[model samples]
Target chain A: MDAPAIYRIALDVMGGDNAPVALLEGARAALQAHPELFLHLVGDEDRLRPLLAHTGLKGELASRFAIVHAASVVDMDDKATSILKEKKDSSIRVAAQLVREGKADGVVSMGHTGAAMVASKMVLGTLSGVDRPCLAAILPNMQGRPTVLLDVGANIDCRPDQIAQFAIMGSIYAEGVLGIPGPRVGVLSVGEEEGKGSTTTREAAEALKDIDLNFAGNAEGRDIWNGKFDVIACDGFVGNALLKSAEALAEGLVQGMKGVFKENLLTKLAALLTLNGLKRFAARLDYAEYGGAPLLGVKGVSIIGHGRSNAKAVHSAIRAALMASEHRVNDQIQASLGRLMSQAGSQETS
Target chain B: MDAPAIYRIALDVMGGDNAPVALLEGARAALQAHPELFLHLVGDEDRLRPLLAHTGLKGELASRFAIVHAASVVDMDDKATSILKEKKDSSIRVAAQLVREGKADGVVSMGHTGAAMVASKMVLGTLSGVDRPCLAAILPNMQGRPTVLLDVGANIDCRPDQIAQFAIMGSIYAEGVLGIPGPRVGVLSVGEEEGKGSTTTREAAEALKDIDLNFAGNAEGRDIWNGKFDVIACDGFVGNALLKSAEALAEGLVQGMKGVFKENLLTKLAALLTLNGLKRFAARLDYAEYGGAPLLGVKGVSIIGHGRSNAKAVHSAIRAALMASEHRVNDQIQASLGRLMSQAGSQETS
Candidate 1:
């Protein structure tokens, strides 16, 4: 069966809050676990070489990993336009180039989100029939399955048509990666009613209703954790902010619970007893559990991790990148986009 | 001075999922707690009259409360425009009327949010120079103090100028109600950078920078729970969706934790021990703890509660209404509006 297509992933070793070291450890761990992986560490050789040597990789596994040298850095402060022109040698840029040059099947970056997105857009370009690329996350729902939300900070201001595209891409990701068949797509709005949102959303909702997928009309914020839909399409501005806020709320509750347990002797004992249970519950809401948000609509897989990501998060991102590429998500997206666009064109002409 | 300006609140007893019974119990509880409050229950006299008598209210405390009958109903499905024109005797409309006639200082409704908001807008009208009425919620931030978020489900689409107005109203609410001397106001966006949002927010931020308030610039979703700003303003569509999403996240986490504790014998024992601690932490994130979201930019106090609110929530809503009126929040908003509008206008011309 063609040996399962050895997935070569370009690891942006110099990205994230904890670079070089965390990336080295995470890459080693991922490579150790996955036999069909060949990781190309894209970063400054001087920084990555020492960390990789010290991470205790066996000789056999080490043979599958290689380092690609490039010194330029894309700081979180680097503007997208500036990264495109000035930071050509940035790790994120080089990682994307690996995919463009056919050296890698996917790229994983935890650095400047905009920088990574811009680099991927310019280097790999977008898939067929896709205009702008977007970010999509798999959020854990109450039903024990994950819901996919797209445009999570890839574009600050989204056109109604873009939202329609998001639904298609998000739906594809759900079906291709999460194994959800014909994912129920929903438009994020203040109300479930057709006419109950901003002009952009109302227009998007109308357009979504016209699409051929399993559209769930409009969904409220409460529907997020309630597992109301398989994929929720929204503008980047709202999607990014909402996800972060929900994370903060969940974290605050966990911390507050910790504080409550520390209040007295009796509670302290209880906290120890239920520590495993609390951890299990927190695992449900942890974004790190899903690895990273995937940069969809692009030509190849690019997973964007948190700036504060640790080795565990990095490991998950690598896993996600492999899954996406192995599933041939881009090919699936290309086919789906062709069908939806033709239908949209017919509607427009009518 | 002048008998401390007694706060008389009219509550729509027929509103909410629990209806007249919850309202009767809540009104009684509020009256018992605050001798300064005089409640006028507005609903069908047939439903409210018996509930109040059966709840075991003494003759003297009962003197502080009265029932006003209103037959016309604003069904949750009823359109806002239709409710404005036809439902003249609806409880929400009647309660709002009591405020306009100076018979009550504030009105509380847990019924159809849009209908209640429309009724308040039409009956009480807006304060002088106020272009739109907005909803402001005191969300609990990680710092233990509340963060004021405005235009939450009030206006789906807001102009840049309207955002400026939201900042003014929200600022006044923080100072007049929460007693913050000069609250730091922020425009909720996708990023914390200057030019990091949509055209609407960029314009709003630019105009805000020209004004006198302590504008905290753009705040991402993380800032909501990080307690970065005391007040965050946004278009109602975004604010409502984000808030509901955060709420769902918190509730989900709480429920998830409960499930974890039910796993086995060890977890069951731990659950019993940490149950109190979990309850305490959950209360910190509870929306009902803060009562209701205030309808700011209006002439009189209007508190919008959840349809599923219990007696405690109803009681808290009444308490918030009393505090807003007692502090003369509308007067504070009126004075602040004049200053902001002139500043916004001057910026436009320049």
Candidate 2:
């Protein structure tokens, strides 16, 4: 009898700050959770083999995974396209090549974000109707459901049409993987008014209005967390700044709270009592819960985790990649873009 | 005996969410704090006279203040340029006009931000050698001293030279007004690397490097709060979004903490014990404590407060205006710009 098909994911274990140890532990957790998952651990084979043995992947479970040897690792300071030339045997490059050659269904990396994006785009290529692949970060909104903010750090200077494409792809991702029906899409701007934004934002708002989706007009920066949008799209520069600023503020506030609670014996006792509640609150705001941001518009699923991702975060990233692949999000994006182009063609001719 | 020279500040009493009462109360507070301050209360005379009488400003204090009546109020939705044509008698317009006609030393408004900017630019005009006026927001950093972030909502699409001008003006403002000696100026970008930003940011960085100032190269979004930069300059759109996002995140976390504390009796007890410590933490992050942001590069000091400004915030704006006028910040800005222009001319000849 033939064996059942398995979902193969290529994870670059040599990337990120915590590196191979955290990644191997996460892989072990993922393998245990999902029996059909077969991981291609792309890194130094000798280092990974010993670590994998100690990580409790014994007996039958050991047969599910394989070590894909990679000679070098991409540095955080390396250029985005350097992996394709000088570091052709880099872990990220090898992982992307696995996806390109159909050896793996998706690629996951916690290395340099730009290098991962470049490797994904150059090796796996973008979808037929997509101009550039964008990163979609699943941020926890006030509403229980997560909001997908696209072009977080990809395509820093985007054209109007490219932004419009992000809205479409982001909507599909939210609807497909996130299970939101007919998600509300918004273009990030200074104001909610139609005419109140930069030239690119204003033009993108106009383009979004013509597309066949639940376009909710312009969303202010406050609207990002106000539960007004299921998906918010902006140029990578603005999105990156906004994301980083929010992260820094949240971290600063948490540290400030810690200092406040440690003022004296009374406050310390109060902190002890409220420790569980604060832990839950912090969990809600933690980016690790969502694992990693997905590189949308690529032909194959590519998840990019944070450099500081822990075992839980890696497990989450692997889960996200599996769900994205299972839901066929790329196909939905292609179909949506094809419809948009056809509609535009009809409008122009009419 | 002759009275000492008074510093006159035009206060727009009919603007902001808590208008009239808040503004009048603030004026009373400012008058009480500084003996040399004389406020020109710009609003309906009938309303101002009655409120002023009830706000504990009697006899001696009443003599220092004067009521300058205006018939109309600029709505929050009013076009930025509408005050020049239609809303001629608006409170904000009259306040700015008072400064233009040399009736007041500086203008303070809590009305429509765009209108305040437009009125300041059109009536008072930009200073010589400065192409555009920008808003500088004093944000609290990890360090004790606050960081000044410029162009918070002014000049969305800025040229490279205009950004360079912002860096210089920001540096001068930080040093002159904020009392930071030789303030470190940085151009806001996605990454700290020189070539990692958009075309505008790259060109602006290049321009900033040549200028005679303590240019700190590129500052990422995280650097805004990390306290590495004394003053960070960026186009209005990015700055506005970053500022708003940070504000929203902080507010959201505070509310989230409140929810966490209210979960049960134990957490509630914990919250009671830490109330004072939490209040102090909140005070540190509150925008009200900072009062208002100054519209720099204008011929005269124009301080624009938030629409939600309460009595305390209104009082702070008046105090800021008084300080800016007393310190002669505008004159210092003019002199700095002149130096920058001459340096450029000499470089060209060489």
Number of the predicted model whose DockQ against the real structure is largest:
2
Question: Per-candidate TM vs. native?
Answer: 0.93, 0.95
The regions of model 1 sitting more than 4 angstroms off are A1-4, A50-56, A76-82, A346-350, B1-4, B53-56, B72-82, B85-87, B263-268, B342-350
Worst 10 residues of 1 chain A by lDDT: A278-287
Candidate 2 structure lDDT: 0.88
TM-score of 1: 0.93
Docking class of 1: medium
lDDT tens readout by residue for model 1, A60-168: 8878989999888898778865667888888888899999999999999988888888888888898889977899977888777788888888888888988888988
For candidate 1, the share of real interface contacts preserved is: 0.87
Expressed as tens digits, the lDDT of each residue in B68-114 for candidate 2 is 98999999778888899999999999999999999998999998988
Residues B168-252 of candidate 1: C-alpha lDDT, one tens digit per residue:
8888778877778789999988878788888998888887886678888997788788788999989898899888897787777
